[model samples]
Target: MSLQYFAGAACRALTARKDGPSLYEVCDPILRQPGSGGDPHLSKFYRTALGNPALRTLLRRAGLPELNDPARLNALRQALVLARDNPTPDWESVGGPIAELVDGITLQHPAPPRRTGAVAMPPAAEIDRVIRACGADLLGSYGRNGFIPTYAAFNLIGDPDIRGREVLMALQGLDARGYKNSTLMFNLARVFIARSPAAAVINPPWRGIAEPMWEPVQIRHRSAYYDAFFTEALLSYLETGLASSEQTGTARAAIAAMVDFCLETSREEVRGADGKSYHVVTALAPPPHPRFSRFFTQIKQDLGFGVYVPDCDTTACSFSAATQAGSNDPILDQPLVDFYAGYQVRAGGNEPRVTVPINDNIDYEGGVATWIDSMAGERPYGNDLDPTLNLDVLEVSFRNLTRWQILETEARLAFIRRIVGFQQRLVLSGAFADPRAHIYYLPELYCAYFGRCYHAFMALPPAARQAIDPGGAFELIRLRVLAYVEDELVGREMNPFDAALALIALGHLGGNEASFAPAVHCIVTAFGEGGRRHPYRAYEWNKMKTPTRILVGGPEVTSAFVLMGLALARRCR
Candidate 1:
C-alpha cells in the first residue's frame, strides 16, 4: 500500500476493524474507550507527518517501495529531522525527493494559469484622492512628538504637546513587541516634528513612540550605524531651536550632553592586573575630541553635520620586532604591519611573540568591535555599556521630556533638512541605493529600491527627468541584476519576495506603453515560464504573503526609495 493509505489504515486500525477487510475505512469512529492504541514508534512517525505536510507528501509519495527496506526510511527520516534544524532554508538543498513528489502531483492535478498583460494603474485623479485620504488619516494619528490618549490633561500633555508626557508612556512599549527598529520611527518622526509647523511648537506623538528604541545605540561595541538616526534626530532638534531665539539655549545644552557622551564613552584606556596600562582605539578612528570640538563649534553656529575625523590621530607606533613568525609574520608584510600593529606585538623581547596566531584576549578579539571596545574600555560587553546620553541617546532621554518649547515654521524646516542631510552623508550614503546589488545569486529587494527611485523621479517635473534620469538609472540597475541572476555562478530561483519587487520595478520602468517589454519579460521569466504557473511556491513565498511582515518594506534594499516607487506607481496610475 502507499504510505498515505498505510498511514490512514493504521490510524483506522485502532478501532472498527470489523467493518472493513483491513482498517482502511474508518473515517467516522465510535469510541468505546478513552485510551489510544499507543504504538510509540508509529505514533511518533505519524505525529511528525501530521505536523509537516511537506514531509508527509514526500514520504507518502515514496510509499512502500522506499519503506519496504526499513533502512531507507530511517535515512529519509534522519534527513527530515535535519531539515527541521534550518526552519528557513537558504536554498533548494532539501528539495531533491520533494521535487519528484511535487512534480507528480502537478501532472495529476493541473493548476490554473497565471494572469498576464499590463496591469492597469489607477488614474491621476484617483491617485491624488488616495494620497490626500492617506495623509488625512495619518495626520490625526500624529502629535507634536508622540501619541497621547485624547483625554490627557494639560501637565500630562507637556510642552510641544506631541513630545511631552505622552512620550514617556510610549517609551515603555516602543521596543516591547516585534517593533525592534524603533530608532527609524523616532528619527522619521523627529524630522517631521523639526520641520512641521504644528510640530515645532510641540513634539509629535511618534517621538515618544520612538524614544525607548534608542536603548541599544549606547552599545559602543556595536557599529556606529546603529545609532545614526538618533544622532540625526537630536541634531535636527538642536538646529531647529538654534535658528529660533526662544528654544536655542535648551537645544545647545542637549547637543553638548550628546557630544560629551560620544567623546567620553568611545575611548578605551584600561589597567591590567599588573601596573601596566593598555590603550585601544574604539571609534571609526581614535578620539576626535578636538575635531568634535570644532564640529560642535560649527553646529553652534548652525552650519550643519560633517565628518569629524579625516584620519586616525592615535599615536602611530610600530609593533615590537620580536613577534615575527615563519611565513605568517605580519611584521614581514608592511601593509599588514601598518593595519594591525596595535593588535599584535611581542610580550617579551627574548620570548617569541608569535607562538600561535591567536591574539592576547580571546573574548574581545581585535575584530570590528576591537577599535570601539578599546575606546569604551574593559566593561565593554556588560551592563557598563554606557546607558547614557550621546546625541542619539539624548533623543531617547529627551523622549521623557514632557514639555518641549515650540519654535517658528522656518526654523522647523531647516531642522528636518539638517537631520536628513546628516543622515544622508554619515549613514544613508553607505546604504543609499539597493545593498543587494552586491550579493544576488538569490534575489532580494532590488526591485523595491528600483520602484522608489523611479517614483521620486516621476514625481519631479517631466523636464526634471531629463536632468535626473531616475527611471533610466533604475533600468540600468535592473538590467545589471538580471545579468547577475542569469550568471552560472548564481543558480537560485526567485522567490515571491523577489518576484513582487521585480514586478514593481518592471511595471514602473515599462509603464502603460509596450516600450518596457524587455523589463516585463525579465519579471515574467524570473517568476514563471511564458507566464505559466511558477514551479516553486514553497514556504519562503508563503511567509512573504504579507507585505508588512516580510521586511521593513521588502528585502530588496532601500526603504525610502522602494516606498517612493510603489507610491509613485499607485499615485501616477
Candidate 2:
C-alpha cells in the first residue's frame, strides 16, 4: 500500500514481457549492496562451516566425516549435514562454521555443463544481478577523468583560433613535405565528401569570448558521443557521394584542393575522370611574434586556466539572435530576457555562452554559416544586429536554454540533411557508384549525428518526431553502433570496411516497411563484406594493446551514448 511499493509494482508491470524479465531485474542486484538487508531468509547464501576446525570436530563427533579442505566435494557434504539441524546455542561454534561452509561451497561449486542446443537463457533474477554489477562497474570507470593526451599539445598552441590556424598551417607544410596529422587528414577526407563547397577555408579555431572557456572545437577521438553522430554522418556521405552547391570558382577550387588532399592522404588514390591529382602548395609559417602575455593573463583571469603553449580553449562559433516572448514583451523574446537577467544581472555580470560542439574537422566556412543561421535572432554577444529590435523590452520571449537533447537532435538532423542533399544529388547524376565510399562515410556520419539526435530525442515525448526514414535510420544507426565495438577493438581508421553495421541498424532497428526501400540495395552493396574491400586490420589489431598502453585516464562520460544507441536498437527490435 505504500507509495514506494506501489511505484515499484507499477514499474514491473510496465516493463514485463513474455521473452524474459526486464532490464530492471538485472539492474537491481548491482544497485543494492551485499549485507544491506535485515531478513536472513531473504539474504544470499554462503558456505563457511566445513572448513572450520571447530565445526569439523563437531561434525566428526556427530558421525559426519571431517572434510577440512575447502575445495573438496566430500568436505562440503559434511558441513551441509551439520547445518541442516540448526544446532543449539551450546553448539554455536559447530553451527556457525557449518553454516558458513555450506554457503561457501554452494557458491564455489560450478553448475553442471549446459547442453549445446539453444542454451537456456539465464534466469531473469540472476541475469539482472550480473548485468547490474557490470553496469555499476562500467559507470564507475566512466566517471574517471580521461586525459586529453593531445590536448596538452593543443593547449601549448595558444588560443582556439590560433590552434585552428596552427593545424591548417601544419597541414599545408606537412603536405608539401608529404606528411599530415593522420587524424585531421582523415576527417578532412570525410568533410570533402559531406560538404562539397566551391571553396572552403579551414579557419583557425575560434575561441568564444566567454567563461568556463571550454574548447568547442571538433575532435577526432572516437567516444560514445562521437560514434553516435559523426560516424553516421560520415557513413551517409560515403553512401550518398558528396554534397554539391552553387559556388564553383574559388569555392570549388578550395573544395577541390581538399579533395586532392584527401586523395593524396589515402593509400588508394582517389582521382576524377581526368586521372589527374590536384596538388597545391600554399603554406604559411608561424610569425616570430612576441609572446602575448595579455592573452594568457586575461584568459586565466576570466577562465582560470593558464594558457599553455597551444590553447585548447576555443568555441566553434558565436551565436547571436533576437526574439520576443512573454505577455508584457516589447517585441523581444522573454525567455532570453529572463535567462540573461538572472545570469547577467542577478548572479553577476555573466551571460550564458552559446556553443556548438563538433568532433570532426569542420570546414571553418560551413561552421560560420551554421553559427550565423542558428543564432540569427538569439542575441548571443549583446550586439544587436537590428537596433530596432530590443531584447530587454520584447513581447515574445526568446528562451536561451542549453539542453543536451536539443543540441544532440539538431546536430543529427543537420547531418542527415547534409548527407541526403549530397547523396541524392550524386545518385541522380552519372558519377560511378562507389560502395567503398558509401561504407566508409555512412557509419561515421551517423555515429556523430545519432548521438546528437538521441541526446535530444530521449528528452522529448515518445511521439514528438520520427527518425529519418525510421526503418533505415534504425538499421543504419545500429550498424554504426557495431562499428564502435569494432573500432575499440582495433586501432586504425577503417570506415569503408565497417559500414555494413550502419545498414544493419537502419534495417533491423527501424522494424517496419516505413523504413524499407530499394535504396537499401545501395547499403547492402556498399558494405557487404565480400563486395567492397577496405583496410580494417590496422585498427582492429591495435584494439588489443591500445587500452592498456594508451595514456588515456579512462573512458569518457560520452561513452554512455554508444551504449544507449545499442540498447535502443536491441529494445526497438
Give the alpha carbon lDDT tens digit for every residue of 260-305 in model 2. Answer: 2222221121121133332211110012111223543343222212
TM-scores for every predicted model = 0.25, 0.24
Q: How many residue pairs clash in each candidate?
A: 35, 124
Give the lowest summed-lDDT range of ten residues in model 1. Answer: 207-216
Q: Tens digit of lDDT per residue, candidate 1, span 1-573?
A: 235644554343223212111111110021111114321222232232122343222222212232345564444334333333333322133332322222221101111133335433334454334223222222222222121001101111111212212222222212211121121122212322222232212221211000111111111111122122122223333322212443345334433433323333333454322334544223332333322334344432221112222111121111110110112222222222122223222233222222211111121111111111232242211110010011121122122111221122333222322322322232122222222111111123333333333444455456533432323543454454434322211123332333334435544544433322222232323332211211111111111100011111111111112222224344333
Each prediction's whole-model lDDT (CA):
0.25, 0.23
**Model 1: residue 426 alpha-carbon error in angstroms:** 29
The lowest-lDDT stretch of 10 consecutive residues in candidate 2 is 310-319
> Residue 230, candidate 1: how far off, in angstroms?
17
Top lDDT prediction, candidate number: 1
